[model samples]
Target chain A: MKNFFVIIVLCLFISLQAFAGLHVVTTTTELAAIATEMGGVHAEVKSLIKGSQDPHYIEPKPSYASILNKADLFIAMGLSLEIGWVPSLLTQSRNAKIQRGHEGFIEPYQGIRILEIPSGVVDRSGGDIHPEGNPHYLMDPRNGVIVAKNIAQKMAELDPAHGDSYQKNYEIFAETMNHKIGEWQRVLSKHRGLKVVTHHQTFSYFADWLGVRVLDRIENKPGIPPSPGHMVDLIKLIKKESVPLVLLENYYDPKPSQKLAGETGVKVLTLPVSVNGVETVTTYAGLFDYIVTQIVGAQ
Target chain B: MFTARLMVVLFCLCLLFSPTLVLAKKKIPDQSSEGQVLLWKFNQTGNKALIPDISLIGIVSGAYFRDDPATVQWPNPTRTGFNLQAAELGIQSVVDPYIRADVFIHMLEDGLEVEEAFITTLTLPLNLQIRAGKFRARLGRENTQHLDQKHFADYSRLRRYFLGNEGLTDLGAELSVLLPVSWFSELSFDFMQGRNDVSFDSPRKQDFLYVGHWANSFNLTTNLTMQVGVSGAFGNNVTVRKLTQIYAGDLYLRWRPHERRGFKWETEYYYRSLEGAVATAKEGGVTTSMVYQFARRFEAGARFDAIGFPEDAFSQYQVSPILTFVATEFFRLRGQYNFLHTDGAGKKQHEAFLQLMFNMGPHGAHSF
Candidate 1:
């Protein structure tokens, strides 16, 4: 019993190891990348998920609570994108600061216009629709500017001592992105009216931004696997529309898309949808560069 | 009888495969040229209605079993027909920044009973959490879970013998600490007001019994995880002597790959010794359960149970096979077959069970 008490006290002391800066936990690698750019030396950022995995499905793990317990701020793409995992982790973290309604929790898509919000009664029948809106808004680089600003402001509030530093870093990130966006727009300018197809609905924001026409999705619904009938219809639509590219992400199985490509003879382009999704796309800026280059090269 | 059973199996197989044919022509969502849909913006101003996260879980199970030679065990659900098993209405909310409250009401044939009502401290110092209210005794790994939360529809013979019909739940307070060791380890100590007949008969007794548990889990690989734990509880029994004690050990191994169905294997062993009350002797048992998620929404599992009563030199063994279908995220159906045999003057019994479980409202994912 004496030794037990000793272990408990020692554990508590280790858990309380104070950090010199704000500690941030983001739901995805892209958000963590944005936070890191804005936070710089003033904060520490950790993402709950890796870049290659699908954000739609995350298995709950105890290590999530262990890391979340130490977070001074939490950032996530709301709109039910993280509905499967983050809510449970917040409840078990035991850190009141990161819970909902707390100042430390930040939803990056608060002011952005969300896409794919259903017009009528929505359920799984519509194929895994987000009750709020489509949460894959980060595909648009302009939204990355908004995400970075939010992180900077949140970090400033939590650690006022470095508020000025965070803002300076935010300004630099915004300017860099502003220049890159113009270049990206020029690259995609010629392909505005071209019809595109994808394995999932994740390209909504990207297609909307570039004015590219997304004709069809291989999967009938969000979580459901594509049926033979659905696949037949999709192939017909792609062939009829002359869609040059059928995009797929790394997180999903490529066999279905490969089959679609084989049947329709349309070129398939697998893009790294998130930061660190591929070795080359290590940063947020590189994500856009890789995606745009792939789309253009495929054409 | 063989033809009759084969007919049932064929019918079930048809029922199962027919859904796949329907899925091939499922409801395909229409394309929206304008994909933007923005609704009311969520404000942090607290203007929105505070809705308590409420959930209702209902389980209806029916079973058929042939009588064993000596006698059926306690609360084993021996009736070989359909029955309205149980339902639970649960309400939970964060009471304040300092605590959260969870309450569950079990609806039974008699009326409604408070299954568990507890408040957990959210903001305690030193990685410490305090839970105060009535909870299942953390004696064995499975004993802490309520009936509706189980993977199997029917209770095993060991659990039926040790935990009784309702399982060993008591009014209790628990304090758990996240240990500082490198991995995921939690140590919890519980003190509870004993229950009637199983351990102590008086609800008014102020003498609190003690139960302790230590659980540690680690990822064996990226997809596999192994968790091991030990539990001990001591109190008074109405049997013969004045004291009753239980010691338990449990292990769970699961392999859950990303974006795929997984498998889980669980084993628990327990030893209970009664002193000076009814029988001043020791009894022991072991239960092992395994589940393989072979399809997207279907799983098959089996359990083996062996238990020895303190009063008798004979022992009982049972084997059960269960097939389950998750119709949706909130609803499930299971069919189970069990074979029970006894050693030393006990007859064999064959049983079958069918169960349906459904849930409504918000219930967050449980701990791993």
Candidate 2:
């Protein structure tokens, strides 16, 4: 009888150990993909916002709080990208471990080079300006390597038993990403310093990375819809600049870009900015692959 | 003495901006010296950093009424002309690592009123959170929300009749717990001073209002979500030396495909039982609304409210259609038309309102 009781207790302990993996929750799909890759089999990762959704204006949902309540590590592409929603959800989650300034809470932008940090007095006249900097730094593949390292380091700190595994995963991801960055840059070497019109400032880092020049944006200011007067001005500018392509994210309205294309005879390349933004773009590498293929195809 | 106070204020301001100045001087110009120049320019402007986030919201409305009644409810435009409805000042900040505070002061025609002043505990064990001071109780969907957060231009007649014109707000302490479940679920309890004359009023110290609410949310689909809550409140009716009880249920369904477009449907039902010396009077009502964002900046919604249900003691019904245009995150323009009918007087009234609201400050995130 004593032996049977001891065996039962041993089985319960083993089962509990088997189920004890870290739960990671992120604010965007790109972070979810990176965290999944870095955490590997030791973590369960989920994203609050889908790839097709706009990260700027998410309505904080109660279900998201539930997901966050159970999180062991909470990651966000901070720089106020989620200023409108994530703060309230974090408070509602009632999980102290994942609050701001905690070991379990990670803002990956701290280690990366931020772009578009405004100077002087900033206000809403710029149409939803991000004061800290552009939160879209992950568009540069090098920044993705930095973010992966940050996530792996945090995960290893939280779950020290799998520290080596997380570090190994980060190394593999970094090497592959470095190699792919080279390949992508080589493929687009001919189009270096290419002049393009974009829908929003979302592609600043991407343009910087590949040596593309954004002459002007369809929307005069960020987050504002393109007005007819602005479109007329943009048409003249595109003609004068000899801009050949207009790059727009998949989530934005395509009508304005289509109009620009109709007027200027320039190609419109609508691409997804996040992983799983489209059916074919399921991985981080796949997102860049699709974007490069589209831009090259437009050429 | 005034000079001394001014000097103290100046000292505080300097204390606030000194860190930014120090950081600016220490920052090394990396790739962009332009950013550093801008930082210095900003500091020269004396933008203080340590102060709480301050925002002001102004609401003005123009109303026209047919068969103008002698009086309208509080916060509704009584006369058929332009009116300065309210100007709200909100001050919010995280006090420290463990707590945050929010204060809202409303300037009405009467005077300034402290609408809500509360402190919330950010860290607690067992998934528990405590909020103390005066605040709106989590009774139902609409009671806990501010007027600016509502879809309509005015409060629902049902809420005005049952929970008083100001809704269930009073000096209270709340304890809420997030349940460990597969979906979102929360349970909250409140202890409030019984000061609302419409429902509960007690002279005894121990006759405090007690409220309990259980809220749950489910993601019906990838784009669809639903939240439902049931709440109950009990207190003493000192006038009759008896007990008063209120029960309510609320449902909210939202389908948001993206940021630019969405649809929401909300309904709330309320019931109250008042014990009098002669007998017990039971009253109930329900209000439901649907709003659809068909465009990036425009949305249309309609609401129906009916009172005196389950017990035909009195009858009142109101229907309102509202259209809103959001120029930006800071500005909004709205138009609403209301049709109201009451059975006692057999009177029908029609009213129209045009409202403009604008805010300036750091954007505050609201709960789901």
Candidate 3:
């Protein structure tokens, strides 16, 4: 049994050595998809958490460390989106190459203007608050442009041999994203000022960009379960606002949203906010395509 | 004493409730002339030197059960009253470029003791990791986890029969080698002081206990994963009056669909292959548990335990149903009921418990 494992490890190493592309590991599926689009042939990207998983609640696994150990570049949403799991992976991987603020490290929240950052002293009572701005910035297509550009620049920095190719790939991604943003805007234009209740705080960025009014969240805080009092309050507000829709994501329990929808006869729409969040949604553009299409069609 | 205990409990509740209650119920304000809503991000630099990622986890439990107090065997006994399960304080930080430190101390009613204190070398070549101080030895699945991390209120029947209150931890170090495989795989070899509360250590023989573990997890698909491992340990038993050997196998299967709610089934089996002179003969048992997350923050699980009842003629079998409610990542409340029946004497026992756990401060990620 021991020799069998050694042979397996040797085989895997040989197979891995065959690929010379730069190894880039990100903390989220949305980032991984964007890295792939921008890195093109120059990089190989692996995300620590699948799109289906909540980035804030990622369970740390030993295998994550091994994948990070070999990474040439590491990407995170920053603002502690991956705080639950990523830091421990970096510590356990012992990979000096991808430590925070290092050349091999890239954080994408730099260019995207952020919101919901508490003005005064922040505490957990704020409901699993992100001391940084909202890390769910990817829900907005415009922010995807920033992520793409950052990923490509980081790739070029780490693998300078293919710097020009990365630069060219990034320009294409940026142009494509800007065009898609215009198209998505047109599709979602009718839903402007539509009132909706979200399951978590994550959809705030999406609502902010699309002119949707976020009436309330089933979970008042990021990770806190909705207290009965809170839910009753939300139901009252939704009735008062006459909110037409209740928005839920693939990673949240639908019961709370369903109960809310049931209370006021409001329509419930479940959407995947990120790539790989659903099996049908597999790319950066596909994420927006699925979400906007669902919202517009449901209306 | 009652007043002091009540005060302590109130203090713990305050610590648990303050985060949400203390904050002003302010809206995500409308965009102002500043362009974005709010500009206050976490001061990244301020956290570097002083904070050091420290966390304190406290678990308070009260239970009532129908078991003879004198013959109590479990740590969280089936006593007909309240007990403090454990209070664990964990401090972790990266010491330098080459090493990091993790320390966990248990504050019990009797005294305070270091649960685990170890410095790990992270920069070793060949994917090798080394820890020089006492750690929760990477021997088996249940043996490695802390008390609060468990799904059930008590240890499994096998663990209770073999290992007592403190699991299989000794003042020794472990060296782990990460296999360079596509899947997650690790092999660990530990050499610890041949001293355990279970008398699995030879008090007279100046020797060390050896434990070996090989574990790996594989993603079957996007929503499903399976982890399996085999572990073995060899040591001298002073009370058993003979050299002792133990072998164990564990399997964990999980199906999580898009991170919302999921199902998990885990089982472990162990065999005390060698017999001790004064102790009972060969004993073996298996524990199997299945849990389903029916709703967010809510989970229901059932565990079946059957273990050889040493020093007696009967083998004990128990079925426990547990309901867990996670109020936050930091706070959890659980209710559990256990029904136990013996084979020979046919003695039946019933136990019920309410356990509350709260964690304050920042904690490093734990092994999944």
TM-score of each model, paired residue for residue: 0.85, 0.89, 0.85
Model with the higher lDDT, candidate 1 or 3: 3
User: In model 2, where do residues sit more than 4 Å from their true spots?
Assistant: A1-18, B1-49, B67-74
* Native-referenced Cα lDDT, model 2: 0.84
Candidate with the greatest lDDT versus the true structure? 2
Real A-B contacts recovered, model 1? 0.28
Q: What ranking emerges by DockQ with the best candidate at the front?
A: 3, 2, 1
B-chain TM-score, candidate 1: 0.81
RMSD of 1: 12.6
lDDT, candidate 3, A33-141, per-residue tens? 9999888887888998877777887777666887888888888888878787887787667565675534566776657888887868777878788887788898888
> Roughly what TM-score does model 2 have, to 2 decimal places?
0.89
What candidate 1 gets wrong by more than 4 Å, as runs, is A1-19, A253-255, B1-48, B67-78, B108-110, B146-149, B199-204, B239-241, B276-279, B309-314
lDDT of 2 at B128: 75
User: Model 3 off-target regions past 4 Å?
Assistant: A1-13, A61-63, A91-96, A99-103, A119-121, A182-192, A296-299, B1-42, B47-49, B71-75, B239-242, B258-260, B273-281, B309-314, B341-347
lDDT per residue (tens digit) for residues A1-299 in model 2 = 99999997676433222346999999999999999999998999999989988898889999899888888899988887897898788889877778775557878764577889888989988888888778899999999998888788778777889999999999999999999999999999999999999998889999999999999998778889888999999999889989999998989888899999999998898889999899998889888999999888878
Reference-based lDDT, residue A57, model 3: 75
Write model 1 residue lDDT over A99-203, tens digit each, in one string. Answer: 765657878774577788777876556766676778899999999998788778778767888889998999999999999999999999998877888888888
**Model 1, B65: alpha-carbon shift in Å?**
2.8
